[model samples]
Target: MKTAYVKVPFQFKFEDVPVPKCGSNEALIKVMACGVCGSDMNAARVEAQDWQSFGHEITGVVMETGENVSNVKVGDSVLVESGSYCGTCAQCRNGRPDLCASGTGLFQWKICGFSEYMTLDKQCLIPFDPEKIGYAQGTVIEPMGVALDLFYTTDIKFQDDVAVVGLGPIGLMALRLAKAAGARNVYGVVRNRKNTARIKLAKEFGATDIIYTDETPLEAYPFPAGGVDKIMVTAPPSVIASTFRAANLGAVIAYIGIDYGDRGTISFDANYFHYKKLQLRASYAVPALYFPRCMELIADGVIDVDKLVTSTFPLEDLEKAMCTLRDDKEKEIKMVMVRPELL
Candidate 1:
């Protein structure tokens, strides 16, 4: 078997490794496809974390399972949960498994998705009908769940003018979900003009407008009265105040972007922040509570996974794919890395 690790300074390396043994309650999975997330990009830059063998959004087939594993059988098609949590914890008991402290080292030692062969507990694998949704679409369930979590946490309604600030993969998925949830005018905001690839798809995903903030000023946002009803910020924290800048009266801003930096401070006028009655909320979704619903949506054709993914890479080309993301982020949207033998 071969395992991959994303080293610092944005590099990818692979080495020969033994296939992990399946435990009594675990499943041995054959890698199918793994979605390259924005978080993966963020993880590639840090010095403190291990980028080697760190991918969570994965879909694969169960090659074998331990004798006692009954949740999934051999040949089951499934999407994997990234973290292991103590089910008895207070957060777990309260249905907030994302907050579980037990799984604090998510990307450190977990080698499942980025490797050619992987192992995970049976409970971490969610089975779906592969005939209905293929492996590529299957990989999206996890990330889509993150977007769905943000949508579920907030209050959105029909005809609400929604603005999504940041056109990354999750932001694009948010655009699709906002449209599906009945937002009348969906706006996609980007910081670069070279992000034209994502902007075009944002329109297809039901973005009524695409705001390239670099070319167009924030003051020129085309909302009738003021700004948008709800703003979903998926970019850096520095841009949060700008979302407030283009916000409507009593708008809710759900922020989910993460950046490593001394660049966290955001400035906005105190009077406008008060007069408009703006609400800013952090949208951190995990433990994949909405995984099933998201999978069903993709399976039933409600959400088109076909449009969201712009490229696919063989596992051998993992470095090239990650570099494409690092060097050409503006032109790229979503990607799937696959092990050819699995399919």
Candidate 2:
């Protein structure tokens, strides 16, 4: 088996290693397609101290099932939920498995989707129809699930005005899901002209308006004085401050972006939130329970996952793909690694 490891900053070395043997409750999945996530970029940039394995948004076929893994059989197509949670944790007891504190190190040490094969517990697998959704489309379920979590936590209703900050994959997915969920007007805030093409596609997906921060101030948008009813921040910490500024007094602010900094701060009028009763919420990856619903949505053709994918590369070109995603931001959206032979 061949695996790509981020041994150090900006360096990826491919090594041939023994294939992992599945445990009694785990299944061995042959990687079909894996999406390079923004978090993977953060990992490659040495954001975390551990030697993190790349690729989490993934779709694969079950090659071998363990003795007790009856839910998934050999040849079943499925999407792997990268985040793990202990079913008995306090957060898990409250039905928020994504925040399970005891399962904090699942992505840090265990195998990731970057390899030719991934060993996942039965709880992390969601069966999907490969005929209805391609491998590229299947790989987006994780990010889409994250977007779904944002909407699930808020009190958004039909025709509500929503603004999504940042045009990353998750942000774009939020734009699409918000509109699908019945938002009247959807706005996308982006910093670079690199996302112009994606912004245009966002319109097709659901965005009614697009705001490029490089060209216009957040306050100058056409929204009312209080601004949008809800704002989802998918950009870095710097942009999140602006997202807070543009949000309506009583609006919901969902922070879905991953920030590594601790120095940035937002200065907002406390009375605004107190008088209007604003809701500030932080959302991470989707809960495991939502995976089934997300998979059904994808299988039903309600959300077009294929359009979110901008490019696909062979597994051998992992480094080149990373560079293209890092340097050529304008030319790519979501990049997937496909194993042609395995398919």
Candidate 3:
């Protein structure tokens, strides 16, 4: 099988590697589609040390199952949870596997979903209905789960006002989820003209207002000071400081952006937070328990994952896809690589 891997910073190569054999408790998944994530760009920019592979958001078909893998069988369509956790870990026992104390987490290394075939532990697979959803939609389940985690961290009421300080794919997902959760007014902030199109889509999905940062200053927005109940920051670290400055006091600020190196810092008014009792929280990947609910939400039509997809590429074009994402942020939202031969 030819596995696509990041050989060095901004360099990708297709290496002919031996197919992985399923372990007793693992399953062999034939890659269907794997979404190229923003974090993957960060990984590609950093020099590759080991023969590491770089994708986590994946959806595929079960080609072979290990002897002990009964949760899913051959021909089952599924989304990979990507984040591995030790069942006995403190966080896992507390039903918050996103904070798994185990060393098997995705943050430690790569999962290599951008390949012809990938093997996963049985516990990391979430079976879904493929007839209703395509591989592109399934591939985004992981990121959507991350968006759901932001809501889980904050108190989101149906009538509350919410704002998202970025219009990336994840930020767009947060916009959609907020509306689905019955938020009265949802706002999306973007700077680029292309991103403005995405923000408009947010309005179609559920946002009541799309704030183009380039057109209007954050302070000039109609939302009053401390008017927003919750805010999600999805912009890169370079823009986060200003985004944080605009956040309403007493609002729940959910930081979802992954800082790329030391781009910049976020400055907050300590006095404002102290007097207004603001809650600042950071949300990473979603917990395993949330996968089932996220899948259910997709199944029930609460989230249209397909609409968020902007482009697709073949696995062999991994480098091109990554370059497009890194260099042309304004043009692309989410890009997914598909391995049709493997499927």
Candidate 4:
């Protein structure tokens, strides 16, 4: 089997590797498409040591199932949740599987994805209709699930004004979800480079206004103080305080940025937060708990998955794809790589 590895920082190489085997209770999944996650770019730029195994946003077909597997079968078009939850955990017992411990996997053992083929427990497999979303687009459910989790972290009441700082895929999807959930006015914030162009698409998704933080000062965001009812900071830690600066009186701010390196902190006006009754919360990937609704949004045509994708490459272009994502911030937003044999 041919597999891709990060030869070093800023590089990826494909080489022949043995195919992974399945356990008695697991199933083998042939990769169809694996979307390049934003975190991949993080590991690429920061030189994270354990980034060789990429592709958490994966969608594949079941090639074989173990004797004990009953929920999934061969020929099923599926996505793996990767055993994100431990049912015994306090969060899990309270029905918050997304907050599950990281040690457990789908089959109650360790699971490693992002190869030509891999094994997972049937419990981790989620079957989806290819006709509705197709193989490549279905891979988006992984990031979408995380975006959905952010929604759960905050109360985005129907018709409330909302803002999403950093108009990346997650922010873009959150914009769309806010609209679908009936946000009266959706605001998008982005840097003033070529990234500001993303605001045009954000408007298409649901944003009513675009705050060019690069051109406009953060303290001057939304103008005259009292701004959006709710804000989600999808960018970095530095953007957290900016959200508060642009926040309205009694607003809720949800953030989801993990700075693996560097100081991930920012300074903001404490008086503003106190006087405005501002709220803040940090959000992270929650064990793929929202896969079903994520798929349903794509399948039901509620989410524009096609528009979200910027590029698609074959296995041979793995290096180019990673480099493009790392360097090409202006044009590329989301990309997926399809390994034909893995399908």
Give all candidates' CA lDDT scores: 0.79, 0.78, 0.76, 0.75
Q: Answer with 3 or 4, whichever has the higher TM-score.
A: 4
Which runs of model 2 end up more than 4 angstroms from their true locations? 48-50, 88-99, 102-105, 224-226, 263-276, 286-289
Candidate 3 lDDT, 174-289, residue by residue in tens: 88888888887888877745754576677777888787777887657878444577888887656654554455656787777766445646666778677767787887664433
Candidate 4 per-residue C-alpha lDDT over 27-95 given as tens digits, one digit per residue, 9 for 90 to 100: 888888888877777767665465365556777889988899998889999976744675787877897
**lDDT at residue 39 of model 2 (Cα atoms):** 80
Judged by whole-model lDDT over C-alpha atoms, candidate 4 comes out at 0.75
Ranking by lDDT: 1, 2, 3, 4
Return the clash pairs for model 1, or none: 5-53
Give Cα distance to truth, residue 180, candidate 3, Å: 1.9
> What is the alpha-carbon lDDT for the whole of candidate 1?
0.79
Say which prediction, candidate 1 or candidate 2, comes out ahead on TM-score: 1
- Tens-place lDDT per residue, model 2, 33-125, is 999988888888857465657778889999999999988999999988776677898888998676786652235436778899978888778
Off by over 4 Å in 1: 47-51, 84-86, 95-98, 103-109, 267-271, 329-331, 341-343
Best by TM-score: 1
User: Model 1: per-residue lDDT, tens digit, 1-108?
Assistant: 888887677877888888888878778899889888877777677742654677778889899999888888898888786655668889889997768766522443
Q: How accurate is candidate 2 locally (lDDT)?
A: 0.78
Q: Better model by lDDT, 2 or 3?
A: 2
